[model samples]
Target: MRVELDEERRAQLPPTWQRAFDWAEESLGGRVVAWEAQPRWRPACFFELEREGEILPLYWRGARGEWHRNTRPLEREMHVIEVFERNGISVPTRFGLCEDPPGLILSRIPGRFSLDTATDEAHRRKVLDEYLAQLARIHSIPIEEFEAIGYRRPESPEQSCLGETRGFERSYRATKTRPDPMIEFQLGWCHRNVPKDRPELSFVVCDAGQFMFDDEGLTGLLDFELAYIGDYAADLAALRTRDLTEPIGQLGDAMRRYSELSGREIDFGVIDYHTIRFALINPLSVAGMVTDPLPQANYVQYLAWYVCYGRVGLELMAASTAVELDPPSLPEERPSRRSVAHVHLTELLDPAQAGDDGERAYQLDRMQRTAVYLDRADRYGEALESDDLDDVATLLGRRPSTWQEADAALEELVLSSSPERDPEFIRYFHRRLSREEALLYPVLREQQGIAVPPLE
Candidate 1:
């Protein structure tokens, strides 16, 4: 019999009952006394509790359901930790996986997760050097164990670099609710310029520069979702993404140290190739959020991040291809049109008023994000829309009143056209994204860039 809870039945429900918390209870073999969501970009559910006599700090290793990222298989991540743990890397000791809620319960590694708290400037520099050493160590791990565990192996050197793209390509096809011209442009460009010359593959964590530390030093290496056997240079190149939030070290200095540690000559061209690949593929992670939002998901916050960093990625991608960047091409700002409700809502956003430290942190996070959008509006407003419509007219030979129409028209043009298959596609998409990025510069975080000369 189908029994739906009415008002009377709902009143009878347990006060402490939550589906996620219930899973945690069963996983821990005790009732969860307290829990809090971890503040991170990725989906994670973290908590601390007592089981019998001992307090256990645990993280639910994977999301509940329906994530669109092209990540390596989750089961592989569990095995990955085991592989590294044997070699004496500092990873969380796994307790066990919950069969129902579907995540690994990891015994938390103790210490501060951020490196910013390290007051000693000398240790900070030493820590960066240690990061490169760790990367070398990870890459040095023999691939035979990974192979034994059925980690996907590439057929050739080209496949080694390009194979990682398959996950994102598959995901974009399945999760994209609308046409994305820029993402299509990147996909097409990648097809045209897959790297042919590459050295031997190694066990590379494609997303490098992620780990936690305490006063003692590198305590816990974290987030290996993109691990695979690929060009080791791609791992070195991926640190550029890390530099956006928390920098590891200077790229050239790290390269030199890496070469010393591994006794392999550094190839800037190969590094640049992987860098361009990073630039092209990164936007797909948040493309769905920007185009069409899912209910209760913070699409607005992610959209701000995408717009800010997506521009930098485009600039670097274009620069890698030796395309000339145009000067700042900004749109005109419109008159103040802040509504009554908008002003009152902005006034009410107070981080201090939040009930707890976590809530305060989250409140501050959204405040900064809200500032980015407000900055975007202050700088460009509806004039940006006009620019997009003009671009659409040029590309499709028809004017579009809204970006949804423009985006669809461009995707139609891109899908049918040979621009994607030809090398000239680089120049074409470069022109589009670079200009768009320029418009968004006002809202972006101030760049503390360490310059590296173009590849030979």
Candidate 2:
């Protein structure tokens, strides 16, 4: 790949498109004949480009806006990919980095980037095995390479657990514009519980189980923006987040296979530590969007799922630590406050009323999610206040008059807590937090998203 640029054409191109024609021609030495914008968040500027009488599927290293403000640029991933490539792992090839805006042009691999395509028993086992093995192989990569790619190594063995914690803090602090006491608490807990024993650092994908597969076999792993040098166990825990949608295989079996491939004993506690740490990131990121309120096309569904994701992570964290939970109390019923026009608009926006299958699903998700939120608000809006007041009063010495007052009081308590002690208080708050999230699950489940309930 050469560093040639057509300033005239580049200026005329769209940022989201990454100026496909000029980019392909300049980066690949090909005349672009066809291309289309693939559906994706941040667009990934993902494209199926045809040039020089062939198809070159591609991805941009950087996204245009704030959708994923924390994405590690493709420019950075280029070096990481080289490290993986040297290690004999499967990944997309970097054609070149664009000179002007510095985007990475990549050659896309074959296969649908999903788990739904695998139909038969053989297909499922083979694909799952390959996926797990690939992850294990990543952990086996020499730790020295991480440094060459700008990844930092922890000074001590035990501190290695804090690797991803740094990234989580960075994201949470940057995205959160207001008070986030639970996130603040979770971050504190992660810091206090750095898992024992220092395992060899591997190039772990902080967000794992995302890859592509064709009819023939598994292709390259996808999205290395979150790749880092840490305990491979971090990679194991990451799969829990994905388990809702693209689960690799049975967790117990996957663990057994991973232990075999890496040739190192696995630590369940370390995995638990990393899993809880990883889960906390969900609430941090989602709470930012939720509080600020994005004008998303499917805002209701987004809010429900966002809240659910946070809830699930907290529940998993509790389970990882062997904390028991009582069933969450049901919300008290009430009358609707929304006008008839509001209800009509919700019905009118149904996917069945308009849009393509994908768009329709998007619309229907929005509608369903909106209905859930509205219905919940109507049923327990007042009760939610009463419950929070009670919980706040229980946590604090007295009840606060306003929701904001209660929030501030709870936050003060969280921030001022002894990081090393108070097991009972921790369990109590964790359950209260889980119950709080339970309020959002019905809508989240109704949206037809994949979910992994607490593992019994």
Candidate 3:
């Protein structure tokens, strides 16, 4: 059945975005008979239509808004996909480019999105091996090929290592409204610890290990939004981060196999540094959005990444520095007067109750998640704020009644303080972020068990 959008929901789309869908329909000379929007931080939708008596599945991936942008433009993504297609890399075929709202029309890859989807061990291994080999293939592409198409090549080793991250930090700072001690401290730490002995730059997928796989093998590599010239070790480190969620077998074994295929030594030190660096991208991208998200933004998804991956960055930092961390205990749960009302709201909005209508189910799922967050916040927000104030007082020698004041004071201290105080700041921020993880625990329950795999 077609996923129909009501008039109210259709009215929410800006004229430009509405035209983007029209552009895709007109370009293909077919009506969009079935469609559903995929709501993961980015704005993407899947459309199905009968063209020339053949059902064509197409994906229309759009930008959130001009206010939030990827490192490269949308046209660049299409070009990169073409490059991958030419170089024998398995990637989704580009159908067309959407100009009005800045998006791409791509043929939907046919396979499960993760290797773990294979029930048999041998099948999983077969797919994992091919995925790693495909990753090596991506890195093996000469830097000049990418540079020929306007992709920037690093001028030096330091630039190769820190260039993209520095750009991310600048964007974070430009739009930053509130003081984030965890983000600030991590930024300072990353800036201080750029890898010196990094390998010659290669065209690495900055967010690697995302592909569609099945019994045969990987169907197509998905997403080129963050592809750029960087150290190969950065790609390996990003794979480790993906392992947290995608379950890609033993990462150390994956690294060893990748080394054999690419003929490059596995630099655990560089991987270690990059693990933290890569994880920081999550919180950095969402810090402003988490603080003040736009109306159309996926606020819960932003929060999910901020805490889940943000904790990965912190844990990696602790591991690299040999600091022992103690995750804070959840404070006593005392339900407020509004907790029952929140429970009722979430139950009413439950996606499972929406039955066969997929679009309604998806919208209900988002609303239910929001309800769960509000319920948890109403119950535990005060205790968490009090705990934060205590942590701030421990660091700054004075307690602030509100979390906002505490954040400002702690951030000022982080900016003005010396590196010698990093361990203390790290400890403090870890405890504070742990509290957030606890508060948002209901929404992020599925991701709670995800941990960055070891490089060794």
What are the per-residue Cα lDDT tens digits for candidate 3 across 308-375? 88788888888888888877788888899989999999999988877876556767876788899889
Which pairs, if any, clash in model 3? none
Please report how far candidate 1 places residue 280 from its true position, in Å. 3.3
Q: How many residue pairs collide in each prediction?
A: 0, 1, 0
Ranking by lDDT: 3, 2, 1
Candidate maximizing lDDT: 3
Clash pairs (backbone) in predicted model 2 = 61-74
The parts of candidate 3 lying over 4 Å away from their true place are: 1-18, 64-72
What TM-scores do the predictions have?
0.81, 0.83, 0.92
lDDT of each: 0.64, 0.65, 0.80
TM-score, prediction 2: 0.83
Q: State the weakest 10-residue window (summed lDDT) of model 2.
A: 1-10
Off by over 4 Å in 1: 1-25, 28-36, 41-46, 64-72, 113-117, 336-338, 357-379, 391-402, 412-456
lDDT of 2 by residue, 1-456 (tens): 112225553454456344545666776776543343333223444555556577666665544333334434666677888888888889988787664444567876778865656877688778778888888888877878778767788777666777666765776678777666666667778777777677577777888888888767788887787677777788877876677666555676777777887787877667767777777666665665667765543555446545556555556666766666554476756656564454566566666655443434654666666666665566566776677677668778898997778767777788788854334445545555555455555655533444444322
lDDT of 3: 0.80
Give residue 363's lDDT in candidate 3 (0 to 100). Answer: 73
